[model samples]
Target: MRIVVARCQVDYAGRLTAHLPMATRVIMVKADGSVLVHSDGGSYKPLNWMSPPCTLREGATDDGQVEWTVTSTASGKGPGDTLRILLEEVHSDSRHELGVDPGLQKDGVEKHLQALLADHPATLADGLTLVRREFPTAIGPVDLMCRDAAGASVAVEIKRRGEIDGVEQLTRYLELLNRDPALTRLGPVRGIFAAQEIKPQARVLATDRGIACAVVDYDALRGIDDVEDRLF
Candidate 1:
């Protein structure tokens, strides 16, 4: 990963136009050919990012200032999106070699939920059995990969709160999983987006994409429901 702190301006062109005036900010160029622009203060989310598959070309502007242009590589009838960063002064520029990460394992709620669901795949659907937890993929690890009664592959994504972004993430996984010939032989891999609470918008999108949504009961999955009822 390459991290550069510089006084730079950013402009994005494609479906819409966005501009960030010159300021000191942190820029990250990941190994996967993605770029992210972040400010000193704000939420964890980057102010702007270009997801791969994309290309980053570093060159000089007409005035001899450093400039980096990132363009999407997606093939389509229309033109691809582009992000341009014009550097004025670089404060600190360094690159680090980060090896393969083991992937995130959130503690408390999220991790517990994954563990419980792995043991009780049927809670998500009838006749669903676990194939692997944290299944590896080219992009990243999927939370769960299971099989239905018909032996078809099912990719499951778990979140504490289901939202539109989560649905979109699951859609990407399904797209890649369905492309595998081994999994396709049984049937096209489907998806199930599971969470404790699902937003209305997310549910709608999942339905439109033909992906199933499962609202899990954390207490029930932990076997607490069998305990005698008690007032808090």
Candidate 2:
């Protein structure tokens, strides 16, 4: 996957001034040729990062609106195929901050998940229960397992941090769960690639393969105290 960051000058204080009003946006393009826009609340106009072999052309301003044309990388053929387009806005700094390190984000997400499971056991979806299981596998045991309620069989494999080949990892786990005669009786086995954010291609591949997947955000697990800290 390729990520591009673009910033626009919405308001300028002065050419020599140290402070300026700038709005930034991020766009992500996946290996499977899908695009996702990360919005920054509601500050700037939507922007997209064109995929490889494509170029963006800016048009004349009209009625206070900006337009751009996307041309193909091919030899003067025409505009390339539009795979995906998304609009995003920049949120105010008072509400949120940008450039959060990936490691920190993953840690925060894991902490929030732990807090949620501890606080709301009943909120877990059907056929899924939290378990602290030890595995004798080559890679080593996992911290938690989401298993089928009745058979106590591991249906989905989970990792707290780091990025793996999620699609392939989940597919292997689902196959193992389904292949087990004891687990097969429980019904069709599936997998969940739970994380802070599910990549665009991963989401599409998981859906196409009949595997259940979810992109869980930490916002859902924030407590009243957390909310208070953010507000104040």
Winning model by lDDT: 1
RMSD of 1: 11.0
Candidate 1's displacement at residue 60, Å, is 55
Residue 165 lDDT, candidate 2, scale 0-100: 73
> Considering every candidate listed, which one attains the maximal TM-score?
1
**lDDT by candidate, in order shown:** 0.92, 0.48
Stretches > 4 Å off in candidate 1: 1-108, 227-232
lDDT tens digits by residue: candidate 2, 106-146: 44655556556535432344656755443333344332355
Instruction: Write the residue-wise lDDT of candidate 1 on 124-212 in tens digits.
Output: 99999999999989988899999999999999999999999999999999999888998889989999999999999999999999999
Provide C-alpha RMSD values for all models, in order.
Answer: 11.0, 14.7
